[model samples]
Target chain A: MGLDNVTVKPHEKLATALAPELTAVNTLIRERMASKHAPRIPEVTAHLVEAGGKRLRPMLTLAAAKACGYDGPYHIHLAATVEFIHTATLLHDDVVDESAKRRGRPTANLLWDNKSSVLVGDYLFARSFQLMTECNSMQVMHILSGASATIAEGEVLQLTAAQDLATDEAIYLQVVRGKTAALFSAATKVGGVIAGADPKIVQALHDYGDALGVSFQIVDDLLDYEGTGETGKNVGDDFRERKLTLPVIKAVAKADDAERAFWVKTIEKGKQDDGDLEHAIALLKKHDALTETRVEALDWAEKAKAALTSLPDTDIRQMLSEIADYVVARLR
Target chain B: MGLDNVTVKPHEKLATALAPELTAVNTLIRERMASKHAPRIPEVTAHLVEAGGKRLRPMLTLAAAKACGYDGPYHIHLAATVEFIHTATLLHDDVVDESAKRRGRPTANLLWDNKSSVLVGDYLFARSFQLMTECNSMQVMHILSGASATIAEGEVLQLTAAQDLATDEAIYLQVVRGKTAALFSAATKVGGVIAGADPKIVQALHDYGDALGVSFQIVDDLLDYEGTGETGKNVGDDFRERKLTLPVIKAVAKADDAERAFWVKTIEKGKQDDGDLEHAIALLKKHDALTETRVEALDWAEKAKAALTSLPDTDIRQMLSEIADYVVARLR
Candidate 1:
C-alpha cells in the first residue's frame, strides 16, 4: 500500500475502535505542553508536536495496549508520554544535526535559536518522566527509561560513527536500533506490560516492535537512496552529511583499490559534491549493496510478522503485521 | 570562616557520612554510563564525567536521605540519578553558553565537538531516567521530574532574557529557581520522601534546599566580582556575557541617565572591552548594588536556616543549616 492507502486504513480503524483514547492522548499532549511556569516551553514544543508528525510512537503504544486486551485509561497517558519523549528528541536532534529544515519546515534551531531547542527539549523530557510517574508502574517506568537511554546512546553512536568509512554491520545495526527502534520496541512492550499481559506475550510484543522498528528504519535509510522526485527529502542527504549508512558501508567493504581510494577521499575526507552523490549511487549499484539492504529489510519485516505469533488473533494485530509489511513493501 | 576552613569541615563530614553511598553512586554512574550497544557513548560521556569535579548533587541526595532518618540502600541509586541529570544539564549548558572552560578544564565542546556534548548530554539524561526508575517511588519521580522541567524552563528563560535589562526580580527569581534551586530542592525533597519522612519534614527539607541553593548561586555571582585575585575566572564574567544577574539588575535599576546609557552601550549593544569591565564594577559599587546583593544572600541564608525547624536536632541537620550560613559568609 502507498502512504495514502496505509494512512486511510489506520485512520478509519483508529476512529472506530480507539477514537476516545486517541482524543485523550491528544488532549493530554496539549495540556501537558502548556507550562504555567515557562510560557516559552509550549511555544518551542508546539512547533514540533503541532508540526504534522504521524504520531507513530504514541500510536504504537495505543495499538500495542489495545492488541494486548488493555482497557485501562493508563495507556493514553503512556501514549502521550511516548509522544513527548519523541518530540523532545526531535527538537534536540535538529540542534545536533544543525539542520535548517524538518518535516519540510524551518527547524526550532533556525526559527528561534539553538538555546530554545535545547531547553525546550529538556522540558519535554521532564514532562515525559512526569507523565510516566502518574502511571505508577515501576515496570512501565523501567521499560521507557531503558528505551530512552538506548535512544540517546544510539544518537551519540551515530554522531561518532558519521563519516567513518570503516563502520560495519554490527555497529550499524546497533545505531539504527538505538536511534530509531529502541523507542518503538519500548512503546509496544510497555503497552503489553501495562495491560497485564503474560511474560510470553510481552516478550513477543517486544520482539515484534524491535523487528518492525528495525525494518522501518532500514526502509527509511533505503528511501534516502531510492526515493523518487516525489519523496520529500533528497536521495543523498545522509551522504551530504558524510553519514556512513548501510549502502556506503557495504560498498566500501566491497570496493577495489581504486574505488577504495575514491571512497576514502569523498567520504572519509569530506571532499564530496553533487557529482560525488551520483558516483556513490553508481558504486552502491555496482556492489549490489542496495539490493542487499532491501533484502535485509524484508528479512526484518518477516521477523516482525513471525514475532506476533504469541498474541491472540485480532484485527489490530493483523493490521500491525500488515503495517510491518507496508513499511518494507515500498522498496519492492 | 574562609574557603579553606569551610572546605575542610564539609569535606570531612561529607566523606564520613556519604563515603559508602558515594562509592555506590560512583560505581553506578560508571556502570550506567556504558552502552553495550553504542561504543561512541562512553567516548563522549567520559570526556565530562572523568574531567573531575565534586559530585555534590549525588551527595545532597544521600545527605538528605540520611538526615531524614532513613537506613535504606535505594537512596544511593537516587543519588546517582540526580547526579546524572545534573551532569547532563551541565554538558548541554556548556554548549548553550558557548563556554570554553568549566572548572579550569576544557569543555567537551572545545575538546570533542558540540555534537558530542549535545548527544552525550542526552545519553546521560536517559541514563538518569533509567536510574530513577529503579527507585520505584512515585513521589520521588514526581519531584525529580518537576525539577527537570523547571531546570529546562529556567535555561530557556535565561536565554530569552539575556542582554535585556528590563528583566525584573520576579522573573529573575523564577529563572534562578529553575536553573539552580529546582534541582537542589527536588534532590533534597526526594531524599526525604524516599526515607518515608513526614509531610512536614519533607516540606521543611525542600524549603531549606531551595533557599540554600538560591544563597549559593548568589554567592557564586558575587564571587565574579569579589574573587578578583582569589578565583581564577575573570571579574565581570557575567557582565561580559551580558547576563543580567542580581547585581547588574539592581545596578541597572538604580542607574542615572549617564549610567543607563553606558550600560546600554556596553551590555545591551555588546560593545564591551577591557575598560568597560572596570567601569561596570565602579558603577556597581557606586550604587551599592554589591552590598544589596550581599544582604539578599544573607536573607536567603537566614530563611534556609529557619526552614530547618521542622527537622530534629541532629548533627547532619545542623551541618546543613551551617552550610547555608557558610555559603553567604564567603561575601564577607
Candidate 2:
C-alpha cells in the first residue's frame, strides 16, 4: 500500500521539466490554430485546446525528444503536432460519442454544433500534418501519419466492438492500441526518431509509450466504473454508453444464463433501467473483473518501466518511467 | 450555344485520355484503404470511394502530370492521394449537412452511420497524408495538407455564414475556393510539381484547377436552382439547408427591405413556408442573379481555359481545357 514509488504528478513534473519547450509548443499551437478568414477555427479549437488537458501526449513528445539529446527547434514542432492531433481526436470523438461535456465543460459540438466540431477537428488534423512536415523528416511524417490512421481505425473498431459481446481481450487490446497507445508510442517514438536516435532506442521509446498508453486507458476504463473522473458523469458511463470495456467483457465472458440475459437486455438491446448500472457493477464485482483488469494494467506499467531501461538515465526519462506507473496507480 | 464546343461526355474523354494512370490510381487507393485489423475501414471507404465520384480531383493530378511530360511513378500516388482527400471531404460533408443522399444514392453516413463516416473520413484523410508522404516530397505534402486545411476551414466558415444576412460574394468565393477549388488546385499543382515542370507551368496548373473548380461549384449551385442536375437532391436544397451559395449571396446583396425580410424569415429564422423557394427563385430571377452567376461561371471557365495554354499542347491538356468549359456549360 506504500505510495513512495509512484509519482502522483503525471504531466506536472514533465511540464516543469520541459517548461521552455512546452511554452514554445503552446505558442506554436496558438499560431497554427488561428484562421484569418474563418474565426471559428480558433474559437472551436480554443474551446478544447485551452481546456485543462494535462498536455500529457505533447509532454511525452518533448520528454522523449529531449531525453534522447535533441535540442533542435523541431522537437517543439513535433510536440505541438502531437497536441494538435490529440485535440482533433477529442473534437471528433465528442461528436461521434454525442458527448455534451468534455473536461467538465460543454463540448464544441454542444456549443457550436456537430458541424463545427467535425470540420474544426479536420482543420486541426490538417494542422498537425503541417506541423509534422515542418520537422522535414519523412520518417517522422510516416510514423505520425501511420499513428493517425491507426487512431481512426481504432475508433471505428470501437464503434462496432462496443456493442458486441463477441468482443474479447484480443479485440479489446487492438482497440486500446488503436485508440490510445498508437499515438502514445508514436508520440514517443517520433521524438527519438526526430532526434536521430538509434533504432533500438527509438524502438524502446515506442515500447514505453505503447505500454503507458495501454495502462492509462485501462485505468480510465476502470475509473469509469469506480465513478467517473473528469468525464463529468456518473459511474458506469461506459455501461450507459454500452461500451464493451475490459471489465464488462470479462464479466460477460463468465456470466451465468440469467446474467447473460441481463447483459443482452442492457448492452445488446440497450434496455437499461436505473438499477441496471448497479446490477452490472455487481456482476463485474462478482467476477472480480475490475481487480483482474487492474492487475493487467499494472503489468503493462511494469513493461513500460522496463522498456525505458534502454534509454539514458536522464531526469526526464526517469519522470516518464514513473508516469507510466502512475497512469495505473490510480486503479489500486 | 453550339453543342459541338462542349464535350457531352467529360469524364469519358478524360478517362480514355488518362486510362493507364487512372487504373493505377484506383489500385493505389484500394491498397492504401485496406485495414490490417479493422474491416470497417475499407467497408466504409469503399462505400464512399467507389460511389461514382468521377474521380475529377485525381484525374487532374494524372492529366497535369502526364501533360507536363513527366513519366514518374509518384504521379499515380499523388492522384490516389487527391482522390482520398476528396472522398474524405464528401464523407464529412454528408455528416455535416445531414444529407441523406449523395452521388445518386444514400450517403455513407446514411448507409453506415455518422460515426462510421466521420471515422472513415478521418481514415482516408490520414491515408491521403500517408500516400503523399510516400512520394517523399515535402512540397507536395505541404500543398495537399494546406488544401485539406482550407477545405475544412471553408466548411467551418460555411457553417457560421450560411444563415447570416451579411454574408456576401467575398465570403461565398472564399467558401467555394475552400470547399472545392483548393483540392482541385492542389491536385493539379502537385502533379506538375511531381513532374518537375517549370515553375510558371506549375503555377499555371494551379491557376487552371482553381478556376475550373470555381466554375464547377458555381454550376453546381446554379443547377440546384435550375432544378438539380444529378446532385442527388431535389431543387432548392441550399435554400432548404439555408446555405448561402453564390446565387443567393448575389440576390441578397441586391435585396430590398421587403426582400431582406423574406430572406430573414426563411434563411435566418428557418421559418420557411410553401412557395418560399419559388418566391426566392423569382427574386433571384428578378435580380438577374442567375444570369450574372452564369456570366461569372463562364468567366472562371474562360480563365481555366486560358491557364491551360501554359502547358504543352497534349491530348490530356486539351481534355482538361474542354472539361473546364464543360463544367459551366451545364448551366447554359
Estimate the overall C-alpha local distance difference test score of candidate 2.
0.89
Candidate 1 CAPRI classification by DockQ: medium
The digit string of per-residue lDDT tens for model 1 on A67-94 reads 9999899999999999998998888888
- Please give the distance, in angstroms, between residue A228's alpha carbon in candidate 1 and its true position after superposition: 3.0
Where model 2 places Cα greater than 4 Å from the true spot, the runs are A1-10, A228-233, B1-3, B228-233
Query: What TM-score does model 1 achieve against the real structure?
Result: 0.95
Error of 1 at A82 (Å): 0.9
Native contacts kept (model 2): 0.86
Q: Candidate 1 — which residues are off by over 4 angstroms?
A: A1-17, A330-332, B1-8, B229-232
Give TM-score, chain B, model 2: 0.96
**Worst 10 contiguous positions by lDDT, candidate 2 chain A:** A1-10
lDDT per residue, candidate 2, A194-232, as tens digits? 899999999999999999999889988888898445445
**B1-332, model 2: which lDDT tens digit per residue?**
32256556776899988888889888889999999888988998888788777888888998998898988799999999999998899899999999988867888888889999999999999988999999999899899889999999889888989889889889899999999999999999999999999999999999999999998899899888985555564688899999999888999999999999999999999999999999999999999999999899989989999999878988888889888867876664
Candidate 2, DockQ to 2 decimals? 0.89
